[model samples]
Target: MELQQLRYVVAVAETNSFTRAAERCLVVQSALSHQVARLEQELGTRLFERTSRRVRLTPAGAAFLPAARQCLEAAERAAAEVAAAVGEVRGRLAVGLIPTVAAVDIPGALRAFRGRYPQVRIGLRVGPSDELTEQVREGTVDVAFLGLPATARPQGVVARELGRDPLVAVVAPGHPLAGEPVVELGRLAAEVFVDLPAGTAGRLQSDQAFAAAGLRREVAFEVTTADSLMARLVGEGLAVALLPSRYAPRLAGVTTVAVADAPERVEYAVWSRDGRTPAATAFLTAVGIDPEAGEARPAPPQEPPSV
Candidate 1:
């Protein structure tokens, strides 16, 4: 009737004594005997024959013993499988990557991760930084690689720094400033700029830099896609834009020059506090970042200057 009753039946049959079965089951002998008796009564059959000298199983008890053992084994195996699933890092993990993040070797890392956790299914999504940040906040993606502004930290998210990508001036190979190690914003104000839209973090950082210098840049072309295409356009001498130095596409005719006193954008591995998963943690570990230790810390406050 009950699983414990079946276990009692199996233990008694194996030991040939209710006293030993009670010891094995960690219960009193009378309690074990009463449960077995209750089980037999519920089945309307005599499961055991009791004598003053020995306890023996009837033919019916012998027939039911095997099934009871099998049932207990099934229960044990089910519990083990569930425990393994929970204890081991094996499940579907969704990761988001911004197209402009070029420092992380995602393909190489993923190949290695697959080799280690073959059972973990990896799903990847590539997009701009804004969308990826939103995905991390919404719990649609387990983790994301984002190009966030220098001082920008998203709410309800934990971010680990992968690298710093400073905004740089990228020009055609034949351009005059192509070989310059660092160019001032005042000098670049006259150049035809291939810049991102007004609202993007990269564009805003550039705008702020020019504002600090009291300069205005002439936007010759505004690009929406911030990946290799911007580099290709710069390579063709269409227009020079301010782009992250790390993400400057590997184009033959493009040259990247760091902007003097430019604000550096940060690349972060972003994940929600509530949505962290074992698979996500494993992936973070694979990339050499400890998810537990990489909790985002508040920036230090600035000291007031003496007038």
Candidate 2:
């Protein structure tokens, strides 16, 4: 079948409407339907079952869909590679990150990358660390920034440690512990807390630390986004929270106290081990990271003037 036919099929399958798919593919409904019909005839099976009310993939369509998408992706990557070989980076860059990432300025980095490579299309996904890591390993995400407890590393991917910071106590400005310059985990454990959802990497850092210290802190509020809802809880004097020191300070209307015996959280940048897209490599470099070494690439020394 033709690549255009595959594209039409995928668009229809995703949108579940021939008319919408044709609109998305910038073709008329009849042309798109004809192409799909031709492909189905060539393969001797219907890819989709169409009713006036709804459209759904047939069993054969379900089987054919994944391979069809892969073929399209392979074709796109091949084109991107040829462009890169000529010193032009043109491809889709899918980036994933945790909500509480603090190691790098993600917005600024993306802006710089966009300015440098206007031809590249960029997409961003915000998710938990574990999910983001898995997306990177699966090649669904080209690059990811994650925060995990010190005891863990991103499995089955190429990762670089971005930075590590101890967890700090965040409380309302008028909270009793807010006045303290430093507080121990045991002391913070005495207070009700707001934290990431149970079993998440963000929450695990504090949980493992408190358990190790032979303390238990009651997490009265569990939130997915720590920067907003969690901080709001802390600022309202509803509960205290343990957050990475680098990120806690940036929260408004809250006081951050150093945790003397806090757990350490590590931030990491991870990518697929199989290979990196040229767009991904360019993004890393634009953000001052070395794609191969997974560290900051040193700047080239200035040349001396010839007299």
Candidate 3:
């Protein structure tokens, strides 16, 4: 039988009058009566004894009232739960982050977001910018912290630029260059260095900076992950590394110096979807970067007229 039929049966039993039950259900008297009658027939039981003076539940009707009430209650609760899961503020959310975030600003952002939306269960994944971008594109993750130069923007993906985290040189303590308060690119270019793996954002940034200076880094080694890069810089004592300043600042055995000429890494965020949905909106607000606010490029300079 339909849910309304069960609800009508319960209401009629409780009110002990078809007229009152119909009014309570905001339906015409005949409609409520018909629904109850349909339910009783479907159940193969006579649920009420009717008389000209009054109406009363039969033994079968009395037995079914509690169960019918329970069924209606269960249905309403199921509807509420589904609504909550779909658009309400309570449920699981998946987020992806670049490695730099675990070291820099994300922990605080996550702590604050958790406090704001306690009912939301957050799942976080961390990796390089390339992988995180792909995850957001593939819908493998709901939202992610990413660096710019994303290889592909999946259709309908939205991005927000949080801020820039510039590249810095990380040299082991006691290294000759560590004592220099402000180490310039010219100095760094001559030093032996452990470079990021070729083709990665970090490596590209390093190459571009050195190329601009008309110098090349003495690349002694290379690594793919930031953690590996940090560990190697500490363990090997062989060469310095170029890393996001936020990550470098957290390492104890390393001295972080802003690369005077290294191109900054622009941090951003990408989400697979968006709208007025509660969790999606909150997720987008937190780490999501604004794309419209990219590095402000200067207008072309006008050359002075020749005499």
Candidate 4:
């Protein structure tokens, strides 16, 4: 019946341990258990089957979990709204970033935001663009930076593009394609590639491009979203990699060439369509994004200078 009881139930469901949930809620184990027990009694159905080894949610508990989470979220949003009305920006802010986004100066933005709102706690999570977009949809991430296809947009999220990052082919200095200004993707069908893993925006784009050209891509090595590793692999002549032009200047021992007919990848500032916290809004502004205007500010063009 009470909000605290709802919170306790949700916490227990998430952690699956009364003691751990109590620790998370900053309360004693007995008190937390008593509150959940009271709620179960009033509802006249056992929510959880607790054993010494583990705690599992019952059928009734499974059905109630989603509504319980919604209630807690609503309460938190209400509190945030009231605090914002008084011009206070003190709360936790969750931010998501892709592993290879280089256009925005994230550290600089965080520095300025800290100077302005010292009380706001910041949590940063890095993942592939697809994973980050899912976190945004789940309400776990307040805002995110995502690299997406030119024609595809995530549903139910408000996205503001910061800029487009053109894809380029990177290879060692002595590689056969190193001297070329632009190389067709189909030409590399026989060459081994150092590619991003599946479920990433870059990988998705690469797959679609090769398929369209009727070329079966061969990846010699699969890597996470770390650009440095990809650069190192390509610089060593292990395999060629498709990367953003922003990396050309920094990656030594590598030549970056344009991929002929390759599609440009767009980076977006994505957030939930619902109300956002004032702190999140301020951070967005600090990062050079107008949250309300939703304007498209293109990044400066990157030409792979001879490096």
Per-residue lDDT of model 4, residues 126-230, tens digit only: 988888888888888999988877767767788887776677888898899888888888887778998888757778877887887888978889998656787
Per-residue CA lDDT of model 3 for 220-281, tens digit only, reads 77766577555556545788887776556655667766566666776666666432234545
Candidate 1: deviation at residue 129, Å?
Answer: 2.2
Best by TM-score: 2
What ordering of candidates by TM-score runs from best to worst? 2, 4, 1, 3
lDDT of 3: 0.67
lDDT of each: 0.77, 0.87, 0.67, 0.83
How badly does each model clash, as a count of residue pairs?
0, 0, 5, 0
Q: Distance from true position, residue 253, model 3, in Å? A: 0.5
lDDT of 1 at 217: 82
- Per-residue alpha-carbon lDDT of candidate 1 for residues 177-219, written as tens digits (9 for 90 to 100): 8877788888888988887787776577778778878999888
Candidate 2 lDDT over 1-307, as tens digits, reads 7999999999999999999999999999999999999999999999999998999999999999999988998898999999999999998999999988878889999998999899998899999999998888878899999999999999999888888777878889899987787889878878998888899999899999989988888988888888777778888999998888777767888888887788889988889999988999998887778987768643334222111
Find the 10 residues in a row with the least total lDDT in model 4: 298-307
* Pick by TM-score: 1 or 2, better one: 2
Off by over 4 Å in 2: 297-307
Candidate 4 has a TM-score of 0.86
Worst 10 residues of 1 by lDDT: 298-307
Per-residue lDDT, model 1, residue 110, is 94
Clash pairs (backbone) in predicted model 4: none
**Segments of candidate 1 deviating more than 4 angstroms:** 1-87, 295-307
